[model samples]
Target: MKLYTYFRSSAAYRVRIALNLKGLSYDAIPVHLTRTGGEHRQEGYTAINPAALVPALVDETRVLTQSMAIIEYLDETHPEPALLPGSALDRARIRAIAQAIACDIHPINNLRVLQYLGRELGASEEQKNAWYRHWVELGLQAVEAMLADDARTGAFCHGDTPTLADCCLVPQVFNARRFNCRMEAFPTINRIVDRCEAMEPFRLAAPSNQADAE
Candidate 1:
């Protein structure tokens, strides 16, 4: 397997963690997202993923896009150390936690979105950062609530083992700290992130640990 990745991309970071957690050794095919006006926009990469996103995976005949979809594919292909937990309800709760970050929080603060807000809309640096903090604060508060209410949450998001929810959570928290989002209100989130980042997979998969980190 080969992964086309950008060093600081949280989405790419998530995939990297998943790959490491599953003990899957894959080649890192770096795609500089911001060099020469985004290499991901180039025709060569657009051919791989028309969405122009980082962390596209090439597994033999199949090429996959979207971090969550790629992760699910990884989980399916390598079932040991499952990324999800038992029971349908538990699975749904875990997914809900994941989506709260992936969909509600991540999209608004994604690189492309922030670039558009600043370059086209004339949003100042402070305003841009405020935009990032706003959504993260709201989203993580809800995640804290979810964690507090759930009996399923253990050392990780869903159980003693890291699940898909923890995979999503760790990356988002990484982003939150990068942008310096207010995290004091979400103690559960902070605790989980601290624990997750201690693991070899999560530590090595961090944005700063990536080859192209600047």
Candidate 2:
């Protein structure tokens, strides 16, 4: 297996964590997202993933895209230490939390959107970061409420073990801290993230630990 990844990309980070948790070793093909007009936008990577996104996984003849889809694929293919474990209702709850971060929170603050805010729309750096912080704080507040209210919430998002939700949560929290978003209000989130960061899988998959990290 080969993974085309950008070290700082949160989506890539999530996939890396899942791969680590599954104990699946793959060749890490670094695709620089910001150097020389972005390698992901160039012909070489576009040919592999027409979307030109980082973190495209090639397993033998199969090519997988999208962080969530790739994660679910890994969970399906490698069932041990199930990332989306539990009953149907439980899975739905887990997915809800993951989507709350990936779909709702991440899309608005990802690199492309931030670049568009500056390059295309002519927004200042302060405005772009403000936009990132606003969405992240609002979204995480809801996630905090969700986790705090749920009886199923344990050391991780869904239960004691890390799930798809935790994978999504850790990366988002990393970004939040990077942007200096105030975290004092989200105790559940902080506690869970602390537990995750202490583990080798999460630590090994951190952006700073990636081979291509600058």
Query: Among these predicted structures, which one has the highest TM-score?
Result: 2
lDDT per residue (tens digit) for residues 123-185 in model 2: 998999899999999999999999999999999999999999999999999999999999999
Top lDDT model = 2
lDDT of 2 at 26: 90
Candidate 1 residue pairs that clash: none
Cα lDDT tens digits, model 1, 1-214, are: 9999998888998899999999999999889988999999999999999999998999997899999989989999899788876888888887888888899999988999999999999999999999999999999999999997778778888888888888899989988988898989988888888999999999989888877889
RMSD of each: 0.9, 0.7
lDDT scores of the candidates, listed in order: 0.90, 0.96
